[model samples]
Target: MAIYHLHAKVISRATGRSAVAAAAYRAASRLHDLRLDRDHDFSNKSGVVHSEILLPDGAPERFLDRATLWNEVEAIEKRKDAQLAREVEFSIPREMTQAQGIALARDFVREQFVERGMVADLNVHWDIGEDGQAKPHAHVMLSTRRIEVRIGEAVHGRRDGIPHPERGGRGAYDLAPDPGPDGAERGRRSTQAHDPSADGNSGDAARHPAEALDAGEALAAAGRTARLIAAARLRHEGLGLAQDQPSIGFGAKERSWNDKDLLLTWRERWASLVNERLAELGPVRA
Candidate 1:
């Protein structure tokens, strides 16, 4: 059976990542980063089945090629820690022929990203999954910023091109103030309250943050089994972080433009495209 596997990530300098290196690795080619005055080459890289550089309908002709496109990306963004690009990794259903798979990838990227005014460098790769099964996937590198055309001239633009229907535009909010170490203190109290030794046999009352202790300690405490203790610990920490990290990672600064919904929407679009292609192909032989 085909699998649904998709992951979206940003190529940022904060994480010590380079978009040129990422593009080279995915497309199995070479790209030079003018900002770092460095040449990134992966032309000898393997497992790239297909690669393409796609742009909006009116994009400059020069960007239709990968090398020129990525080099231009490196040159335009002068910030030392600029976010170079966003990448989406998704699996292709093996039921489709290689041609169908490639077409599906190109069509998906063209519609979901390029049509939305972003340059897309898409690649189809063949590799092994953790289970050692053959994994045929697509790597889509999206421009961090969108393109705007004024009087037929293509120029770099902000994300204002894509707007939330409800919100109208991006909104600003007061930064949530830090609530101090109360969470850590609460964890220690909860640990002691249920401790077996607190009743009698439990050792000294000295309690540390649950995370500060290991799983073995819960098993030795014997009040709650290791599993329950671990579960409770997770719940406590999850609550502490719930305010900041959404379940789907929305609004994460770690991502390009801090737009969390971008990945989710792209994944859904790719899945739909894969299904549409499968339906068109009807029954395919292994």
Candidate 2:
């Protein structure tokens, strides 16, 4: 039988939870949390069939490294009660094969979260119970902020009529990524970085100005995602532009995300995705 279960919640420091630790546990890996000066090791943990980090199209490639991604997320937030990350867990229809299950989860995440500009750390677990049945489920740790270049109002320099020495880099600035929380260790006063408006000379499309001008339909669709991110930013900052939101993945949640209706929407979406997959496999399996 197909069971629908979707759970979402914020991981807050006020509740004594750390994103690094949560990620390590879910991925069954070891990660050194730079902010806490400690290591979260779950290398021996079991039942983790797959783990992956999904970023927006224009996001930094370096963030592919799980440890680096979460550490950078931890570095960007400067609040004791800060909402570090959002987590979603849902059940996968037991009738589906492992490969089908993986694909289903990945597709849902890419469309719902990644397309919306959120970074998602996806972990799929297949646990076997004493009844000899596999209880397969997916756990997704999502970044509250959408991926984008965050520039400060204080202009520094220019390049081709663009902000060259752009402000805002307390968080994950690929030009100069912060080493620790609040960047206090490195004296993060001015985050002067490279010319984002530069051409292919930089070799990094994520930082290049041509990114917005990309001709692909996918890239063009980023405009809608951008608006969604911006709206979330305002909601995260209490109805105004927030300067502290990082260039990294840690700030500004979509206001509607907190609404109960949104959860129902997600639930419906999940069920629809699952049913579509099952139907393709036929009624017997479904």
Candidate number with greatest lDDT: 2
* Clash count, one per candidate: 2, 0
Candidate 1 stretches greater than 4 Å from native: 128-133, 149-259, 283-286
Q: Which 10 residues in a row give candidate 2 its minimum summed lDDT?
A: 152-161
TM-score of 1: 0.59
Error of 1 at 11 (Å): 0.9
Report the lDDT tens digits of candidate 2 across residue range 162-189: 3233222222211112232323313221
Clashing residue pairs in candidate 1 are: 197-201, 197-202
Instruction: List all candidate RMSDs to the true structure.
Output: 19.8, 16.6
lDDT of 1 by residue, 81-175 (tens): 45567666777886766787788888888877787767788999877678986678898888755443321111133121221112112211111
Q: What is the lDDT of residue 190 in candidate 2?
A: 21
Each model's lDDT: 0.59, 0.68
- Tell me the deviation in Å of residue 117 in model 1: 0.5
